[model samples]
Target chain A: MANLILLKEVGEAMNKAAIDAFPNECCGFFFGHEVGEDRVVQEVMPVENSKEGDQRRRFSIDPKAYMDAEKHALAMDMSLLGVYHSHPSHPAIPSEHDLKQAMPWFSYIILSVEKEAVKNTTSWQLDEARKFKNETLKQL
Target chain B: MAQVIIPTPLRKFTNSQARFEAAGNTVQDVLKALSTQHQGLKTHLLDENGELRSFVRVYLGDEDINFLQKGATPIEANSIISIIPAIAGGIV
Candidate 1:
């Protein structure tokens, strides 16, 4: 299992995204590098939704965000190590849909917020066959 | 024979089949058989260099193949493999 670390900035960013997308859903990607032993967040890419109504909260990464993330990672010599999205009213964990979409190598982070208050946050890594296995998150 | 569990996004490529029996002694061989049966799926699972794509994950039963032998991970007749893609989204 790979170790995961969420920097304080990541928490703050997630919180902001959660609040910004309240009553709906907010999604974004987390870019960072492996520093000696831990993954650190260097950038956050939040994209506008193309879907209509509450369906926007279901989750999807904008194609533009992928290009931007790739550019940023190349510049920093880091990788797109993880992705983060908020559960407006749900807990921070991988839903069944999340499991189906989880990539094996990237860390998946979920931020759970209620009424603008951060409730919980967690990260997951995909197993060989792409099942999400929970990973401990250390806040830096 | 090995069982390959298809994830939803990739089901279209597999003719909407969720699982299929593939013949192989190793993960690579099984994947090769799958790709041969479902054209274009190999591109989704492997990079141009034949390396597992960073975004695709393969699991043997409950264990990740990466922790085992990667594409070379041995597979028994009844082994089950799962393919998962990375998905992300939220309200904004």
Candidate 2:
């Protein structure tokens, strides 16, 4: 399986975003290159949690934001490798809803936030059956 | 005919092909042609009622189709359509 190569600063930024969002979930896109089977993240851009209902349990990015992210990635000469989101007060594990909403191509990074601190961070990739399998995270 | 830029997530359905030439005058028509060519991708882009899925975002050049006429948005032979899957998830 291809592992995710996340820059240390990128991980910290995502953790900070998760902390800033607090009880609510934070979401964003990862812009980078795919080196062979590994996804190497070069940049992370945070987006608004546009989910209508309680944001504490769920998060969604507006379609316009997605378009903007694509444009941004193109300008940077990078591809949209995956997404990063926080699970406030929950574990860094893929939920059933995550599996249902996920696409097999992108890596999924989940951060567990409790109170104002980030507790855990994990990456996942969907298998052929559309089920999320733990993806190795290599911090550089 | 419009050139559809397949996002990486849906590339598997297209046999890892990134670009596809589909024939249609509107976003819906082009998507129909695309799905017809790759039947495995239909369920991902459309719902049971054949409506575009909420999580699937279609763009004509730099503009999102929803900002215009949505699936009814018109296109030309040289137009480039991009399919971007909305990135989202949660604890629940």
Candidate 3:
């Protein structure tokens, strides 16, 4: 329950999405089937950012898209593990804004992309105090 | 009039009620009124210029306001409105 096991292809697809949207932030959803004490990811579903402007520094997922992701996960017999976004030319770190917006029981992954290439990536989740704390990632 | 469902995390500002009622024919009007009714909510829901914060998403039932008329989106009597904080973050 404490370890997040990400599939190799899912990470690659996430990196590709980030690279494709270089210079602007890209966002998406990840879902997985639950194993005994492990959440093995199954797929990555990209979502369109609905933020009006400042795509380079900010990102917002369309609420409609969020609902769609839930339905899609349900159809695939997977539970939505969390969401992911790319930070072009930045490190994979969650911000104060992220801390304020995050809800409980969801994982958040951030991919660092620099100059059209993906760099480091990290994942976080909200603790009991509703603060985002780093979580371990096992890339398979 | 419409019923605004405040998300769970924001319920501390709403006396822990899941929702509250405000009178208005449009989403913006109801939101503005709700902010007035809740003293400390003005800043959380709106910026200094009275604009909806970029991280705040308003939904009329299941549809986002952005795809519709935005804040100007009209509301029917007793319609349900949901205010959700937009997910935000990036590379540090």
Highest-scoring model, TM-score: 2
lDDT of 3 by residue, A1-140 (tens): 37788999998999999998888999998999657766677699988877787888888887777656756765776777788998888788888767777766678999989876898888888876767888888899
Give the 10-residue window scoring lowest on summed lDDT in candidate 1 chain A.
A62-71
DockQ order of candidates, top first? 2, 3, 1
Ordered list by TM-score, greatest first: 2, 3, 1
lDDT of 3 at A7: 91
Q: Report backbone clashes per prediction.
A: 16, 0, 0
lDDT for each residue of candidate 2 in A1-140, tens digit (9 for 90 to 100):
78899889898899899999989999999999989988889899999999999999999888778777867876788888888999998999999889878987789999999876898899998887878889889889
Residue-level lDDT of model 3, residues B37-65, one tens digit each, is 88767767899989898778888999889
Model 1, span B18-80: residue lDDT tens: 688988889989888888899857767877887878767687886778789999999999998
Predicted structure 3, TM vs. truth: 0.67
DockQ of 2: 0.67
**Top model number, DockQ:** 2
Model 2 CA deviation exceeding 4 Å by range: B15-18, B47-51, B60-73
Error of 3 at A117 (Å): 2.2
Listed in order, each prediction's TM-score against the native is 0.60, 0.86, 0.67
Clashing residue pairs, candidate 3? none
Which residue runs of candidate 1 sit more than 4 Å off their true CA positions?
A: B1-43, B46-92
The 0-to-1 C-alpha lDDT of every candidate, in the order given, reads 0.72, 0.88, 0.81
